[model samples]
Target: MVLVWAAASLAPGAEARQSAFDTRASHAVIMDYETGAILFSKNGEEPMPPASMSKLMTALMAFEALEDGRLTLDAELPVSETAWRRGGAASGSSTMFLEVNSRATVEDLLQGIIVQSGNDACIVIAEALGGTEENFSAMMTERARELGLESATFANSTGWPDPEHRISAADLARLAQIIIRDYPQYYSFYAQPVFTYNGIRQFNRNPLIGVMQGADGLKTGRTSEAGFGLTASAVRDGQRRIVVFNGMETERARADEAERLMRAAFTEFELVNLVEAGGGAGQVEVFLGQAETVALRAVEGLSFGVHRRDRAGVRAEIVYDGPLRAPVQAGDSVGRLEVTTPDGRIFSVPVEAAEDVNRQGLLGRAGTGLVRLIRGG
Candidate 1:
């Protein structure tokens, strides 16, 4: 039940399996946030309508606006006639009950968009920043590309029905990661339960929040063609997991499936503490340093999914070809620790130098080389 990943340069998760994403979802994926690992996927890379998950990127743009001094939680904005008319209704269409000619703060619009999924809020924010939805969409596309969302396109502020509009669950997960990672300040707003504006209170529609354990915040979307979807994230026992579910039959099904996957992840995996900053988990010889060698350890914890009975075979091997040369960066990778379980399940974590060792000049290198040669002889 642990999330699987398709490999990537810096991503983490399980390897790909064609049938892994064979849930009720038409397109779906569960991913590990830290490592960009694809845990599970089915048609995960296919470009399908994103419904309101497009709001994730919209939120990112708002966050960027806040950072650059163009927008703020307290800054007020006017809901345009066009935005109000187009969005702010149900039936899977824009509907926040926004009134034309009403003034709403950037924060107000955000809650309406994020919590209520108001189309008006999306357009209002788009116009407030990009001067029009068309321009804002361009910005969204640009930012998506910048954040490695290689499979996303924006046609409108809200993810309504459109043949040309589409996004992948993998891309949605990446979008969620970027917003949370790069815009921590603005992201706190996503967790609020109820947003009150214009004398009305609307509760958050995301089922994961308040119900699922550690489910704090994210966005959801739905359309006849797109189905129900969410880019959900949660942290259980210090490890964070993210999921993107698309084309679900019912709202609750997505929540139930996501919760089950999250539980599986928390229970199956273990986070092992490796080296601390300036602390060594193990030592490797240092050539030409004042000392014979220096120590290395886990940067944080080297936690992974190891079955209970297999813990006996969970042996660690510190790998390095030979003594490391001096002038090494503090966080430089000198080796890797491979952990193998009794069942032959294997995982590898990068091993980094606990501290920097300045390279000794030619004389120092020669001295170490001669010592090594003499020892060999």
Candidate 2:
């Protein structure tokens, strides 16, 4: 039973109803998944207790450790008395049902925390990463700021509730965005159905997983004080939509609104191919080098979510200072490719030099100069 919120607004010129999901949440926000651009937001920037959303940051720190090869997924983490006492079945909180003094692998613990909202797993992960929960909370805050999640602080790895442990829906969405974008491999764990530990079956709490198309995985949080909130991301036909809601009236409502927003985004906003990845909108000359000139292409690819009716009105332009000086690397940013609608909303895409161009050496310079002199002397 997904109780969707009333959409209170829509993007300008969009055909769909521009309604904001009427959330009882003290705060709510809707955003473009790909670019972190806000579509509609209310109290989106204010810090509030994140509940289990704090686990998202916990998982992210673990992921960063994994990415840098500082930790391995198969590594075992010892369950401390503090972690076990802080969580588990009798604690009236989420758990992988871990036993005190028993150990679980990093991968399994991650599944527990993300899929099951296991506070036990959160503490275990924090201990494994930073030696103690307090130190880990400090690390989480530092990393949160580094990731641009400035409106957040981590009082505990599990978000068990302290006055200072707070985060905004926008910051929560930002953390989710990084999880999906940077750690593609481990991020898949968020989509799993359940994490079975010590004979207990704990299902993922995210509601949009199976019901919504391309809604693979993300984290969800709920507490009486925090009301009901969710951070959801969905991908459709290569485009992604991310939405976060806090102060929703109910869990089902949060899920329903998430699905509705994603569907609307994919339906109303379509990415038209402007340029192929590593392909040219055009070419440019190199002042001096092994090559006289080289192709310049978008750093990634160029695409835009133009309203279906406005596709024909889209315009693209490459802005550069001038011809590039040689000694350019293959992937050097020389300029920006701007995409604008007839109405003038714009998206700036980066354009990069396609190949390296070495500057002419003294001998090479003299040879070129002598030839020029012979040609025009």
Candidate 3:
């Protein structure tokens, strides 16, 4: 039987609900990792200086180089005068405290960049990979475009104050997603609490790690122009959430708001199972076939996140082109099942034929056509 589901209409009593979180940051976004749902957003798309948080992109490039065998964890790269003069202790920015001519392994640099927010480490990687910091920033911008981050523009690898350096909270969240999805092996470095270098141990600057439950790797940012920012991720019950917030007044506020938003994203919403795989959601008429109708089922199980209070407004609809023709086979693509939440997010799953239906014989076709004509079909 072809299952034809009527488009669901919004219930009269259903009302749209707003997020309860009142964030202190100037820009913020909370997203569900599995469903691609935006739990909350405020100025999320507006471009602003990413500050040290831009190092995530720098780290992504290094991870890519490592994966491609262009670099290795134990391989040591020589520190350049430019890296020393511009981003080193003399530059008064975050540094790994490398001597002018000292060599450091790729692993140590990555740890320095991630744990200590070392600007010098970023510059060292930039010089090692692209031969110059300018070239590396340009490469970062090109890679951001390839990654579909339209709002991201890199002026420097360290996220130093530059009028042209900018990225949106949404883009930061997307960047975090790519890092987690693409570089799982290297991502553990982000969670490291401390890295001892040159006999000096510095704790990871990320606020969420260790303080928030299930929180793992990510980065933090701060500059006079960008204020304070954080790109954080956490996993709970097998579900991960990504959050990016910037332009907070202080470190404490950034930490508090980030943790609050992360908790709310996982707690306020629920994963609702809408349709089970291989189960018929509805049926549709079949023309000139052995069976008069055919059932339709989602090719896979369908589920989505819904706000607990707004669950009443959530609706699902099976959408297909038309009444199917004969010779239908099980698993044939038919249409899509769409689930819409009260907040206006739509999640779609493929619909398929539940069973086979052979074409009718000549006489059977004629009889069916005649019956259909009498019924004014």
Candidate number achieving the greatest lDDT relative to the actual structure: 3
TM agreement with the true structure for every prediction? 0.67, 0.67, 0.73
Worst 10 residues of 3 by lDDT: 1-10
Provide the lDDT at 18 for model 2. Answer: 24
Per-residue alpha-carbon lDDT of model 3 for 1-377, expressed as tens digits?
22324433334334445533457888887778766556666787889999999999999999999999989999999988888888788899988887778899999999999998888899999999899999999999999999999999999999999999999998999899988988899999999999999888999988888998899979999999889989999999899999899988898888888788788878876666667787666666778889988888877777665557766675666677767899999988988887666555667888888899999999999998899899998
Model 2's TM-score against the true structure: 0.67
Best by TM-score: 3
> Considering summed lDDT, which 10 consecutive residues are worst modelled in model 2?
1-10
- In order, the Cα lDDT scores of the candidates are 0.72, 0.76, 0.84
Candidate 1 per-residue lDDT, tens place, 1-377, comes to 11122112212332222231136778776667786655555677888899998988887888888889988789988888888778865334656678889888887788888888888899999999889998988888888888788888898888877887788987898888877778777777777788877778788878878888788779988888888777788887677877788888787887777676556555644333333344445667776776666667655545443333333334556667667767676788877655443333345666688777787878877887898799992
What residue runs in model 1 are displaced by over 4 Å at the alpha carbon? 1-22, 90-92, 268-377
lDDT of predicted model 1: 0.72
Question: lDDT of model 2 at residue 305?
Answer: 53
Tens digits of per-residue lDDT for model 2 on 1-377?
11111111212233333232333557765556776665445577889988887888999999989989877989998999988888887788877889999999998888998899999999998988899999999999998998888998889999887898999987888888888888899888988877788887877788888788788878888877786777878887777777777766787887776666566666655555666677675566665576777677777775555555555455555677765777899888878776555334456678788878889998887886788789993
